[model samples]
Target: MRAVVYDTYSQDLSSLEVREVPKPKVGPGTVLVKVKAAGVNPVDWKVMAGYLDPLMDAYFPVIPGWDVAGVVEAVGFDTPEFHVGDEVMAYARKDVVQGGTFAEYVVVPAKAVALKPAELSWEQAGGLPLAGGTAQRALDTLGDLDGKTLLVHGAAGGVGSLAVQLGVARGATVLGTASEKNFDFLRGLGAVPVAYGEGVVERVLEAAGGKVDAVADFVGEQLETTLAVLADGGKHVSIADGGVAEHGGRYVWVRPDGGETARLGELAASGALKVEVAQSFGLDQVAQAFALSQSGHVRGKLVIVP
Candidate 1:
């Protein structure tokens, strides 16, 4: 099978190259998927640059991705949850960094695989897993948002946009922060929009009619603003900042859950939740995709057709 592999960490994109590699063997309780598409996330390149080195182990010749939407080709022993020809998607992050979804094929634990909704395009499904999972996790951490006011920083981003939709579905009036160009986009997602920089707290407070009941920080480095805008006794969580824990807010790292993935697929299938794919690239052009992701200005997800 062919895959994009990086043998060593480098800030430069030169380390990533496509090459023929040995096929991954399906393990017990796992399924081998023929990769149709993979999502290119910030973590993919961050892993390549060793930014996550302290958090996870990396094996050499690592394949660089975790989000996938593909068809099952085979199943391993005791994996009764999936079978051949089943379409699935997953946030298939392994404890070790290797055998990633960027390849022509990837072996995933059956517990991590969820049926991909037929309504979603391959790119949309591929891009949905990680970002959607992260957004879901953040919302879950905020718990009981019904009839409350929720604020999402970087709300036009991949995770933040989805968070807005999820919060709205739970009966929360959502306030989202983004650049002027993305205000319309956030409003389309059912969020009250506020400009992100300079006096954002005042804008959010004014928009929310006083204070926000909950806050999800998808973008980092705004502890002061979050503190100021939050209502007394409100909940706050940050996926991007560990410092949130120090300030009595929760710090979240999204986990892979098949149930959550399936629920998101249902929402997408029902046309209640939408995954916006900003751009896509062929497998050979992954380097360019990673470069775009690192720029941090992309409005939605980027995908690779493997």
Candidate 2:
């Protein structure tokens, strides 16, 4: 099978290249998926650059992706929940960083795979896992958002946009912080838009009519603002900063849960959750997609179609 591999870490995209590699063998409780699409997150390039070296060990000739939407071609022993030819998606982060989703195929644990909804295109489904899971995890830490006011720190971003939509779906009145340019995008997602720089706290207060009931901080570095705009006794969480814990807020990390990911697929399929895919690239063009993610200004998901 063909895959994009980086034999070693680099400060740039110079190491990523497509090459023919040995096919991964299915194991007990695993499934081999013929890759239809892969989602490119900033962490893909970060992992390649060794930014996550202290956290996870990497093997050479690493394939670089974690989000996938594809069809099962083979099922391993004892995996009764899925069969050959089942459509599935996953936030398939492995315990070790070796095989990845950015190839013609990938082998995943059956516990980390969920049925992909037909309502989502492969690109949309491919892009949904990591960001959708991160968004859900952050919001869940804020407790039930129903009838509450919630503020998202980076509302126009890949994860932030999904956070805004999910917060809205939970019956929260959401206020999103973005540049003035993306205010309409937030509005369409059912979030009231607040400009993020300078007087952001004041803007949020003015927009929400008071301090918000809870906060989900995606952009990080907003500890001061999060505290300033949050109601007393309100909950707060951050995916970016562990410092939030110092301030009585929770720090969230996305976990690979097939059940939660499947729930997101069902919500999206029902039009209760919508994933915005900003662009698509061929498998060979993964380096270009990584460059776009590095820009940090993309409004939605960047996907790889194999």
Candidate 3:
């Protein structure tokens, strides 16, 4: 199978190389999937650049992708929930081989895989796992968003966009922060759009009519500003760093949850959740995909069609 492999951390895209490697074998409790598409997240590039120090235990020569949408080619012993030829999507467990989704095929735990939404194409399905899961976790960390006023920082990005849609579905009046260009897009997702930058707190507070009931800091650097705009005792959550101590709110690190993945698929299938793949690249173009993610201005998720 051909995949993008990197030997050392470097900011240069040239460091990523396309090469052939042996196909991974499916072990017990695992399912082998023929990769149709793989979603690229900021974490993928961060890991490749050796910026994720806490994840160093996973070792090197890693594949560096967690979101996968593919068809099952085989199933290992003890895996009864899925069968050969089933179309599935998953956020592969982070502790495992960094996932092998960048190749023609990869293996993931059966518990991590779920049926993909019928309404979504492979590209859209591939983009949902990581961002969708993060959105769910961030909202869940807050007790309840229904009838509350919510603010999402960086609302035009993958996770932030999903968070806005999800918060609206949960009955929250959502205000999202994005650049002026993405304001319309955010409003289309049922969120009030506020331009991010100087005086962002004032802008958000103005949008929410003085204060918001909750704030999810998808962009960590603006944590202080987000907190200042929230109502007293409002839920504050951040996925980027330890926001618990700073804002007196919960801090979350998204984990693979088959239940959440299946629920999200149902939402997509029912037209309640929508995933946008802003860009697509071939397997050999993984370097370019990584470079695009590093730009920090992607409107939606990027996928690699292998």
Best by lDDT: 2
C-alpha TM-score for every candidate: 0.98, 0.98, 0.96
Clashes of 2: 0
25-126: candidate 2 lDDT, tens digit per residue: 999989999999889998899899998999999998899999999999999988989988899999989988889999999999888899999999999999
lDDT of 2 at 72: 99
User: What TM-score number comes out for model 2?
Assistant: 0.98
Show the colliding residue pairs in model 2: none
Clashes of each: 0, 0, 0
lDDT of 3 by residue, 64-172 (tens): 6889999999999889999999999999855644456888889988888889877889999999998999999999988688899999988999999999999999999
lDDT of 3: 0.86
The 0-to-1 C-alpha lDDT of every candidate, in the order given, reads 0.91, 0.92, 0.86
Higher-scoring candidate on lDDT, 2 or 3: 2
Off by over 4 Å in 1: none
